[model samples]
Target: MADSQLALFSALISLLRRLGKLDDNIVLAYTLERGKKLSMLSLFYVSNVILALFALSGMNIPMYNAMRRCVPIASLLLGPCIYPQRTTSSIIMAIILITAGTITAAQGDLDFDFKSYTFGSLSVLTQALYLLTLQRMGSDNKLGSYKTSSAKTLTILYVNSVNCLPIVFAVVFLSGEYNSMKSYPHWSEPGFLFALGVVTSFACVFSYSIFLCTTVNSALTTACVGVIKSALTTIIGMYTFGGVAATPLLIIGQLINLSGGSLYTYEKYRLQKPASPKPTKKNSSIRPRKPKFTKTARNSSKTTF
Candidate 1:
């Protein structure tokens, strides 16, 4: 578990450096900037609920299957509805890229394999929805200009938690997933509390925390995270389950997925111009003044007349 966390931390640092935040001073600048002042209790409760919900989802193989079956439909529907105000071309491009990436990632799974295919499709779909929702909600500037990042993060987290409450309750009461609550568990134990703790912590930092910090440019973050998660999950699954190793098709698909993600990110960056450097106000040079020869010129003109 500790090793996994270390690996994730390393990945996060690599990402930050890629985003041009390698220097300690740059990181410190952001750290010192004014941030959303959210109450600890509110953050705690919301995070707990969100983690519990994910744990609940992990417990139910059947429910996961159901979500996989139904989620793609929702994902397909999400493409058109997000940011109705944005240009049609941009929206369509997003849909195309996401769909392509999803299909590429899901190619290795069995035919009609809802668990793998749907999960990949649904992940991309939900991410699009989340970005659209944030855009509609008007971001840091839109929602009354009160530095809304904190509030927005809190709201999304809370809403996610509330949405999954029924699932949590169902798993707790109906499935009895945690009956052996005190089992001495390694990280591999299926229903262990500590495993949940570690996984939730990783999700919070890697998934939710990044979402909060990079809400506006989330497409880039999502693309990076998606590729990493998909590749890593495939590698882990292959080694653990002793399946057919990743084939040439899978490799090609991964390359395409990464390329599409890069395109989307490049397009977004091109759309948003970076801030220009502020002009310096201090001028050291002085201009020469016109000589006081007005009187001499007037006398000379009168004499000549």
Candidate 2:
């Protein structure tokens, strides 16, 4: 267990660096437009690619392994759209939540296939970093022109989607899995069921929407959203798939995550009232500004005098 956590922590650190770099790049790209910026559009294109993978990957763990590779990139790409100012403590709390959730996920199937485990760890790490990046990007930074959503979306699409060509190539060349794309039913196919299910997308999309919202604390927003996604996914997976049972530990992890996020939210906004200055009476001669009408009449009387 300790070894797994250490591995995950290492991956998360790397993922955080990647995310920070991606966010910085977005800011840079806004300041200076380059041909490579065009490639970022691929981030959006990969949405289709991810969907295609789900269609053919079948109901198994390998597809998730494939998704793990993409998680970090996807999450980092989304950094620009989140709220601002991710504090160090908040980042730590987020790591704990995501890591706990992941540990819960890894409980069974001790097959210990190093490759699959590695990829899954990477994917979770990437996702956690992405959440942090969202916290970083959620702010309205007055310094950069690309601070807004239009610029952010464009930047991510260009960098992640277009730059994803290498990944696309690797997936196509390295794996026979992607070769028979025709084997999977297209969107037009009748009664086609998507692998991993729309629930995943729904949860993700909802989380992303929350990221874009004007919340008081970016960390709390992320934590709350993560908990919702993790809980819902677990519930659906346990109930529908009947593949795994929910462990008490997993429930406890969710509670802890929720508690952390709620605390942050309360801390960020609760003290904002400024104490109303205790309503102290000022003894100074300086008076409040008179009404505009009264001032105007006073000026006219002064002119007459």
Best by TM-score: 1
Please write out the lDDT profile of model 1 over residues 251-287, one tens digit for every residue.
5555555454455456656667787899999766977
Collision count for each candidate, in order: 0, 15
Window of ten residues with lowest summed lDDT in model 1: 26-35
lDDT of every model, 2 decimals: 0.44, 0.43
TM-score of each: 0.51, 0.49
lDDT of 1 at 299: 81
Model 2, span 1-305: residue lDDT tens: 11122233334334655677445434333222332443333333333444444432333332242223233223433444543243445544544544454454444333335554554444444454544543454344432456456445333323332245455656566666555654666746544445323444454344335445422244344444444445455556656655344566545544554454455455545445466556878878988886676776777777542
Tell me the lDDT of model 1 at 187: 41
Score residue 303 of candidate 2 by CA lDDT.
53
| Colliding pairs, model 1 | none
